[model samples]
Target: MAGDDEFDRWISPIEMTLNTLTNKKVRGNSIVDIPEHLKKSNMKAYKPKVVSIGPLHRKSSRELLYMKEIKWQCMLSLLHRLNPTDDQKVVPPKRLKDCGEVILKYDEAVRACYMDPIELDRHELAQIMLVDGCFLLELLLITNDKQLNGEPKSKFPVKVSKREEFLSDLKLLENQIPLFIIDLLYLKLFGQKSEGIPNIINGYALYLFGCSSGRPIISPNRAHLLELTHWFLTSRQIEAKPDQERSAPETVVELTIDPPDHEHMESMDIWLRERDERDKKVSKETTPKLERCAARLQAAGVKIKTFYGKNRSSSKLEKDPVSVMFGCKEKFEQGVLEIQSLCITEETELQWRNFIAWEQTRSAEKTWEQTGTPATEKKFSQYALLFKGLVCCEYDIELLKSAKVLKVHDENKWSNEKVNKFIHDIAEGIQIDASADPKFCEMINDLNSCDKGCCRFIMFKHCCRILLTKARKFCRYLYRLLMRDYCSTPWQTLGVMAAVLLLFLTIAQTVLAAIAL
Candidate 1:
């Protein structure tokens, strides 16, 4: 495939990836051993993870990367760690080599997979992992007693819990419908991505990490991210590079299951149809649409057959496969949940903790003013915007002080009639004139939203009322943009009388120089 060579190029070798699940045997100086037979096997190491599957492919797949063939020096000891049971001292009657190649299959579409490592109850764990936000695949490596070095590694910050200690069990709920999503909740909230995998998984992770820019920095598309994730899911199925080193150990894939057969699933429509006056249970009437949906699911099938141990009591507790359901609010919530997948975890917390600390410091510095005025104002971050040429070119520090005062008292909340009028007179000069460039109007409108968030935070500092007025004025100015758009009233007409002075000064300077010549 021509696309094969192209696919070969992306999928870049990032400089530092916390080693794949395969090589994780050496934890804290301990050399964990793998099983005997599998240890001598040879395999390839992965390299660029930039996959451009584009928009369509992104929406269609869960974009999981399934594991494949095992190769390592310590396959004998590593296999012991990967066993389904936690009892390392007690080896099962059957050795790992006798179990045949422990094949791994991931639902690239659903983002689900299975692992026997210390045999977790497959059905039970699967339900827990099948949650909304992120479906994680955790590969734990236990170090050999022989390799114990004295030094301890630092702990990770902000731990995200896995369902029953494994994330693959959650894959049973992968929806058939393709989705395009970028989970940025990690950067905003705890700030981190996951570990373990080929180069493809790591690349998709970097893409997710790149979206947290607060400044004028560019952000990548949510759609393409979905595509890259999908490709990573299916990565093991692809052909290996000839030049790739053979001795390099590769993470092995485990078991895979087919998509659930949901044909007999009962629907809400069937549920309502079965409703009888004799039973007459519901005190309140459900919407016709909801009743119908419930009825249909009743006629079709339910995913969960029984609640763990409790006898079912609530009528609302009827079981159904969540992946099949659809609606508007569901989509919105899904967006939120997807972002939540970005939550940093205990394993990889250090990298993101540093990121959060840097952000806070950077924000503080950016808002601080170099000019020694009020101690707070001098240190305020917005002061950076003032000098960087964002606020106003002609309006000096003094006018900005007045503008800020107005932004608070009058703008945030309703202003008294008189003071508001005075500020309107002041802002009149700042309004874009008809002769001014159209770009000026566009830029201010954009700047205007940012100023809104800025003002809200500033209110936190000063008596909230001071900044409140300026914020409100900025807001009212924003609404006026729409008004002007409709009426074609030049901004100068609004309260722009003060602008005449500014205009006069600009022209007089040119005229005076000409006269001097």
Candidate 2:
């Protein structure tokens, strides 16, 4: 009887969980782990380093508890910022209670953003979101201080070094809260108006972390921080219509042999079809692995420079080289390749790798939706694919360095070889489909064709010039042999002159003898 009761107790909870599965489906799906294949390269980059933001990394370590206290302080500071008045000072606890009410109102929606189930009570989950969202707002407000309406400092200044680390931490894929939730909190607290100027947090969070300038504008449809950043990096190029595939030019052979007859027509057709299929497979297999590395392209008279245009704004993110590492931009031209200056450090690997992992997952989801096949999926890791194809060897890194386009700000600890290895390793196992960016694909194709054909043309012209110069020298030597006395050695020339004089004298004697007779 006791054994039966124990089994019943276990089975009852299982049945209850099964029954609630339909309601649980609507909760959320914002957070996810790095895909299994991506973790094979470097797992550490996918994990949070200094601080944890959302529920996924909430229990990352015991040491992160202090950051929670900091979050609370941030929440308090946010309350003061929202309701600033000269008449009366607001108590922190009472202000928190009022904020807590607003958080509670949208608690279920906020909870739905996370993919994992939150075991905490509604009040606890709301408090977590409020604290984390406020923490992000406070950080962004400080970073975007120029846009602030001359508000005096209420919170102490974060150290320059600490501030950099904080920004890097916030970019982690797992440490993201939905942008809508942050906007919701902002609306509830600040009431959608910031005097006359726009609030920095609401207006520029996408711009700060995302590469917004030369790309598509931020939309409300963004899922989370990582998604926003992914869109900025690739949205414009990936979403553009795919280009048509042109077949490489082929040679035709003519023969006097008679064409196949009616009896062989069907067999001939089958053979022709098989040959075409085989040719296609071979062509795909033989497609150029790399169009040209930095060094090879430079050797072919191609120039590389830093990209600075009307689009490259001098914002705070652009001013700080460290922040730009999150989303570097570039532009490729015919003979000139211009890239945004990027300085990679030890701290940035995690942010980049996590973004890549999220992109890989999202791309898979999109492919599953569109074509129902993972193999034909388009990647959102477009920049990673470009870099992977660009840096095939050490010379490529050297070229980038000589061009002053690539920078490594690792306290000079990383050597050129080490930097080369790092960039290659980051993109080692990626499967880059050339169809993802048709413009870039065309750029690469044109470069490869030009490198091969253009170099041959230059070489042919050089060989022709050398041949012509040698021919001129040989023709001049032959003319001098016949016309000039000093054309050969002195004795040989004298001997030839003597022979000619003797022949002339003999001829004159013969003529005189004939006259005497």
Candidate 3:
């Protein structure tokens, strides 16, 4: 009997952790036909030179919670898109896809992006849980100050100090994110595998714990959790343990602010008041110092020229909306960024590079089919050169058209010579056309050589947050042009047809993905 209790207590934390992570409780079936519409339409883009989009929203408290519920509920959700499930904890992005072998490689490289250099066996589940929890707490504190009557919530659902409550919530959030990851791993290794994510991790330990009145499945180990959490929040560049030699540190969510609005401002106040850790060195009434900080924005506002980085060497600004708000009104800017470190090992990096190469190969093949294959002796330009020539991220709305072209060519059999020609054509087209388009020339006239890449990236980036600030600025003009050319078939030809093709392609891609797995 003593042995039974001892054993039950032994694995309770581990079992509960698995259960929470494996919990899938959300479902959303919104049929967004944009992808389908896009593929069917014989899309010819009158690609706008510089379209602005932001300020983009990061995970807000409500949004994060909602995301958690979604992940807990939705069984079909992808691993990379776990923001909602883990209460807005960011996941490492997969570097590449569109090919099985390539994807496997990228999966390795990108996963390494999550390693913690300070720990041994950095891949161990408990260690990841600590950092994951800390990251969630940090995002909440950074995004907005949520004070419930100037207080925070606790994860254990037990009463505690304000700081403790915040810490508890953060821990719960962290546990929620990686709990499933570990469970799924264990289940796949030990449990009976059917297909996809298992219905339950059927390990003997889990089953025994469950059968023993479930008490052993949920015993809390505060001391252990606290020690792990401390290392996560404050550990410096400590080398990883022997087992975690290649592991990276956990990424705390990078919280960006948008232009300030009444609601946003209010939310910020609440978040900060509730989550701020009380320091003995500082007074309890430490009003948030906002003079240096940007403001939170409302919807339909203008994006600012401001860019916030967690550290140096970060991406450029042009993501927030406070500039328009400030220019138009006395609005503040606020945005959130979640920077989750990946488990980037040498192996992982190799995988990503290979995956990227495979993608290039596919794109090249497609170009060849579009035209004719190049001779073996022909030396041609790399399409990556085009990426270097253009601005990156989502700043360029016009480039979506180019991306569409590339997407069309991806996996297709195209001639290298044709691709080389196409590259020249696009470049020549831009060179000749830039001089002709008054707006294009005027917009870039003052920009120096170095600034030129920014211009191209801005022109080519999609209507994503990184580029949306500009895309928003330009999308209206684009929409206006689309409407004016209503009589023209750009929309009709591309829109309807693209939608149909997208559906077919989606089905095809799903099948291919299954085979790869």
lDDT against the true structure, per candidate, is 0.24, 0.56, 0.26
Please, what are the lDDT tens digits per residue for candidate 1 over residues 1-517? 9898776533311101111111221111011111222112210001001111111112232322211111111233333444545565454334432322111111121121111121333333322222211222111111111123322121111124532112212111111111211121111112222111222223333223321111111111111222222222212223223332122234333222222123212332343354444236533321111111111111222111222113423242223212111100110111110100111122122222211111122211111122111111111111111122322212222223332211222233432433233222222211112112233333323332221113334224333444565677789998788467544656546545456678999999999999999
Best by lDDT: 2
Model 3 lDDT tens row, 238-312:
222333221233432211112234554455455446434423344543221111100111021213232233452
Point out the higher-scoring one by TM-score: 2 or 3. Answer: 2
Give me candidate 1's TM-score against the actual structure: 0.18
How many clashes in each candidate?
95, 2, 114
Better of 1 and 2 by TM-score: 2
**Maximum-TM-score candidate:** 2
Q: lDDT score, residue 379, model 3? A: 9
| TM-scores of all predicted structures | 0.18, 0.60, 0.16
**Ten residues in a row with the worst lDDT in model 3?**
46-55
